[model samples]
Target chain A: MKTRYTYGGDEHIYVEIDDEMSLDAFFIALSLSNMVREANIPGVTEILPANASFEVRFDPDVIAPDAMMEKIKAFEHQAEAQEKRLDTRIIEIPVYYEDPWTHETLMRFRERHQDPTGSDLDYAARINGYETVADFIEAHHSQPWFVSMVGFVSGLPFLYQLVERDKQLEVPKYLRPRTDTPKLTVGYGGCFSCIYSVRGAGGYQMFGITPMPIYDPEQKISYLKDFMAFFKPGDIVKWKPIDRAEYDRITQAVEDGTYTPRIAEVAFDLDAFNDDMTGFNAKLMEALNDA
Target chain B: MTLEIIKPGLATTIQDLGRPGYFHLGIPEGGAMDRLAFRAANLLVGNDEGAAGLEAVFMGPEIKFGAEMSVAVTGAEMPMFLDGEPRETWTSFTVKPGQVLSFGFLKTGARIYIAISGGIDTPPALGSRSTYPIGALGGFEGRAIAAGDVIPVGDGSVVAEGRVVPDALRRRPGSPAELRVLTGLYWHRLTEKSQKAFFEDDWVVAPEADRMGYRFRGGQPMEFVDRPQPFGAGSDPSNIVDGCYSYGSIQVPGGLEPIVLHRDAVSGGGYFTLGAVISADMDLIGQLQPNTPVKFKRVEMDEALAARAERKTMISEIRQSLS
Candidate 1:
């Protein structure tokens, strides 16, 4: 795929690896971003890695835009030639599907949704060929998702399904963005799903709410003591659908600083995955189970 | 030392040179909008150029100094009052204990930077003392300073009053500010007519102006080049697959008004950005008043870089003059 490099003023350079978002496209973009970070190119102040794209904010005074572009091209080539295995973590996040909080939120913003007559879950379920919301929920948590990008807001992780492209769930964002989304709400838009790290403006359709806090600036939660943001790029997430009782229990545990997300170390090999998607996925699951 | 907030003006927040290197985490480099004014205030008060200071919008806050300390105010032409007596802005003055420094209605510009001899000693969040309320991090209690809030101040024992920023050094937007724009990013998405109209038209700053972005209206509704929507991009003609948003990136959602993302905006979104205001000209956006007319002047990369250098040189000149 041809890459597009465009300037964002004098300070930033946006690099689009592909117009379409896919795991394969994202892997290459991540690889290049990783290489650029490792190089520690002077004047490169901030390197943001998005799905199928990346941006670098730099000091033009120190490193000219042309020079930065040349180095990025070299790094991209080098990264493409390197092995495609990435050391990552698989974390289990407990989600309460069709939770009351998000339901109320989505209901409040129905005027902005594609189907004002139905709930976000119902609309998403109908569009994706699910007989009922329950079936759609099953399809959502049936497989793990890859954390392709973490942004738009503090600690928000955009998840792309681990399954093949044909099996991916596609949903359009709201006709207009909602001014308020419940924090930790599980939101789906386009081919990706996201957990709202903070309560703020969002366009994604609300599906559920997770008790697990992805971001804690206060570090009140013990597990998040290391960093404010929990999810990182390249991390894999396994969703565990829980009832209200379990959600409450986890929420209590989270407040008590006793709850810790179940995380497992895993190494992803793109070559193996491309060769046999089913076989590699089973192995990846095995790795998570082993941990 | 300590300072008590007697009155929290409209959208008063603590800011510095901003925290960088965390855009990947979606935290913006949120600091002073007018970097030169911020630096001038700090330099006037013998504090570090990047020291945390109060950035007040149209209205200014009433801060009561606990003890005699040197302070300076810069940016925005406003009437300053020291315990009901008129005081000059852009010139450092000594405020005694129980003497509350305040301001009247702003005549021109939008934001003003108030630098205390000792900078506001707010705890740094992700390496910045800038108050970014959305993330609920930084500044006093990770939010805007409220009235009666007691804020900690660093050692400002080194005090030399009456250091003034010359009138010419004060940067204020003209009646119709000519903001330079570097057309790139998703500029190709806009029709040629729309592109030309964007440059030729005069836009007014909407009331939606804030630290997040400056929304411009009054321009002809932009028309996008029609094409089948991309796989993941939203249905809107102005929508693209969510991409990283740069500081000063101008996005026109649904081919309507352009909103230039500022220092405190989200790092990425799905809106189609036509281009970005050159970094050198971004500071001007902060001082823009509501209903102020502005024209987007297109500039090439070389010209943008030259403008950046010129801004840097001017800052250096200020530093040298102050020193």
Candidate 2:
């Protein structure tokens, strides 16, 4: 892949890994960003990984813009040459589909949706050729998703399905954004799925709600003791469909400070996954299920 | 020392140099919009350049001093009063306990800065006292100031009085301000005509402008080169696969109005960015009021860095003069 590096003023360098979105492109972005982070270049302040590109914010005084550009080019070349094996965690996120909270919120803002009369899930399912909402949910959870980016809001992960583009779900954003989306609302837009980390304005088609919080500003959760955000750029998330009773139980655990997200350590071989997705996914699922 | 808010004007909040290094988490680097003015106000009162100060927009707040202390009002040319007696701006003056500070009218600029001898001592969130209100993070109670709220002051005060910022150093906000920009990222996506119009057209700052971004109008609707919308990218021609947005980057949402991302903008999004305002000109954008006409001038990287260095030198000179 040819990396196109552009200057974002003198302070930032935006590197486009590819023109289109692909798991391979995201993997390259993830790998390059991690390498950049490990380099600890003096002026580099922040490393932001996105869907098909990454950006580095730096102080021009400490490191010249040209010097930083050269450093990035070198890192990109090195990252491409190396064997792409990433040490990542597969997290099980319990989601209650057709939950009452998001369902009520979605109904209230029906005018903002693409299909005003039907529910967000129904609209998404019909367009994707799924027979029912339940079938759509099954298809959504059939494969694990790679967190391509963590942005838009704190801890909000933009998840791309691990499957091929043909199998990936796509939905249009709302005609107008809704002013009120409940926190932890699972939303779908374009070819990405996300959980609203905070309760605020959102434009994505709402489908379900996750009982567990992805963001805790107070750092109350043990896992978030060091950082308030839960998801990283390359983290994999598997959404497990749960019932109302399980949702309530998890919600209770979270409030009681006993909820620790189910996470499994897994070595993701990008090359192997690209070759045989079924075998790779089966092994990945076993690793997660064993945990 | 302490100050009580007698009348909380239009969107008054505590701000400093802002919190950086957390953009990956989607946290905005919220801070004083007019950083040059913010630093000037602090220097006048003999405080650190990064000291927290009160930022007032459009209207100024009426604050009552709880103790005798020195204060300087900077940025917008608002007619300030100390206990009903008119006071000059851009200079430090002492205020007695029970003396109420107020403003008459906004003469120029959009935002004003109020720096006391001791800085506003709000607890830092993510290493800065600046406020990010949308996320309800930082500043006093995670929002703008309100009447009857008392703000705590730090004891980082130095005995300084009558410090005045030179008129040359002070920025005079005007219409059709030319802002220098480095055009890149997705600059090639726009048509030749649209790209030319982006620079040639005089864009006015819309009323919807705020800390997150400044939306501009009056430019010809931008047209992009025809291409199949990439997967994961939105259907709009202007939309690209969600990418990292640099602070000061300009994005045209529907290829209509352009929004210049600012200090409190979301770190990354799907919008197609064409250019970014150079670091030195960010303060100029900060001073822009509603209806302020702006023209973006594309500059090279060398010119942008030279401007940044010049601004740094100017700040140092201001600090030296005040000290």
Candidate 3:
């Protein structure tokens, strides 16, 4: 695959792996960015991996831009040639669907929504050919999703389903952005899904609320103590539907600092998955369930 | 030493060069908007270029000195006063114990920077005193200063007083400022007519502008080349597959308003960015007030690099002249 590299002013170099978002493009970006980080280049200030592209911010004073670009190209070559496996963790996120908080918040901003009469979940389900919201939620949780990027806000993961393009759920963003979205609100837009890490302006269609926090600045949660953000690019996430009672219990545990996210170490083989998704996913889920 | 905020002006906060190297974690490089003015104030106070200082917006703070200190005011041209008596700007001055420092109406520019001999003594978070208010991270308990709040001052050694930055070095924020930009990334996504309009139109900064981004109006609604929207790309014509955003990149969402992403902006989004404001012109953007008219001028890579080098040389000259 060809990659396009462009200069973002004198300080940043943006590398676009592909024009479209695909698991293959994301893998290339993830591998390339990881290699750049491991190289520990002195002048490189930041390595931001996105859906199908990555950006590197460097100080030209410390290392010439040309030299830095050359180094990145070299890293890209090495990354592409390396093994197709990636060392990452699969996390299970418990969510309360059609929660009251997001329900109220979404209703208040109905004018901004495409279908103001119905809830976000109802609109999403109907457009995607599902007869009921429950069936839509079941389809969403049946398969795992890959964390293609972690951005837009701190710890907010943009997840793309592991299924083929035909099976992927697609929805349009709000006609206009809402002034406020409740924190941890599980939102779906375009063909990707995300959990709002903070309460701020958002245009995604809110469907539910996650009980656990993906971002903890104080690092109160043991799993997030090392870093304020929980999700990283390439991490797999499995959403689990939960009742209000379980949601309240998990919320209380989170507040008491005893909630540890269900995470299992796994080596993802991109080639194997691309070749045979069902066989690959069965193995991937087994790794998580067995662990 | 400490300084008590007798009257907290509009959005006063502690800032420095900002936290870098953490954009991967989705943290913005929050810092003083006007880098040139920030460094000027620090240099005037004999502190390092990255020393923490106070950034006041629109109105300046009324601070009462708890101890004797040397200070300098830079950026926006605001009327300065010491205990109800007039004071000077762009030059260093001494403040006696119990003296109250204040300012009058803003004459020009948007932000005013206050630098003391000893910098603001807020403990650094994530390697800088710069405040990221969205995450409530870094600088003076991670929030804007309020009245009755007392902030600590570092034991910074003072240089001779009355050191002034030459008038030529000072940036004059004017109406319809021409900002140089290097068009790239998704620049080709826009149609020829829209691209021409972007450069030809005189854009007015909206009043809702803040540290995150500056929205502009008056340009013909930008039009994109027709194409099938890719998966995960939104329905908007300006939307693309999610991509990384440079600090100064310009994005036209919904093709209506063009927003210039700033130091405190999100790291990446699905919006299609036309280009970025060159590093040298970022300081100029920092001084842009609401309703300010601006124009974008396209430049080559060589010109951008040369301008960046010129800024570096200018900073070094200012430091040498002060020392």
Model 3 residue pairs with clashes = none
For model 1, how does the per-residue alpha-carbon lDDT over B245-311 read when each residue is reduced to its tens digit? 9999998866777889988988887788998999999889889999999999999999999999898
Candidate 1 chain A weakest lDDT stretch, 10 residues: A76-85
* Span of 10 residues, lowest total lDDT, candidate 3 chain B: B230-239
lDDT of each model, Cα atoms only?
A: 0.88, 0.87, 0.86
Per-residue error for A37 in candidate 1, Å, reads: 2.3
Candidate 3: stretches off by over 4 Å: A37-42, A62-71, A74-78, A286-291
Return the TM-score for each candidate structure: 0.96, 0.92, 0.95
Error of 2 at A243 (Å): 5.3
Candidate 2 ranges with C-alpha deviation above 4 Å: A98-123, A172-181, A201-203, A242-249, A287-291
Model 3's chain B yields a TM-score of: 0.98
- Please list all clashing residue pairs in model 2, or write none if there are none: none
Model 2: DockQ score: 0.59
Off by over 4 Å in 1: A286-291
Sort the candidates on DockQ, descending order: 1, 3, 2
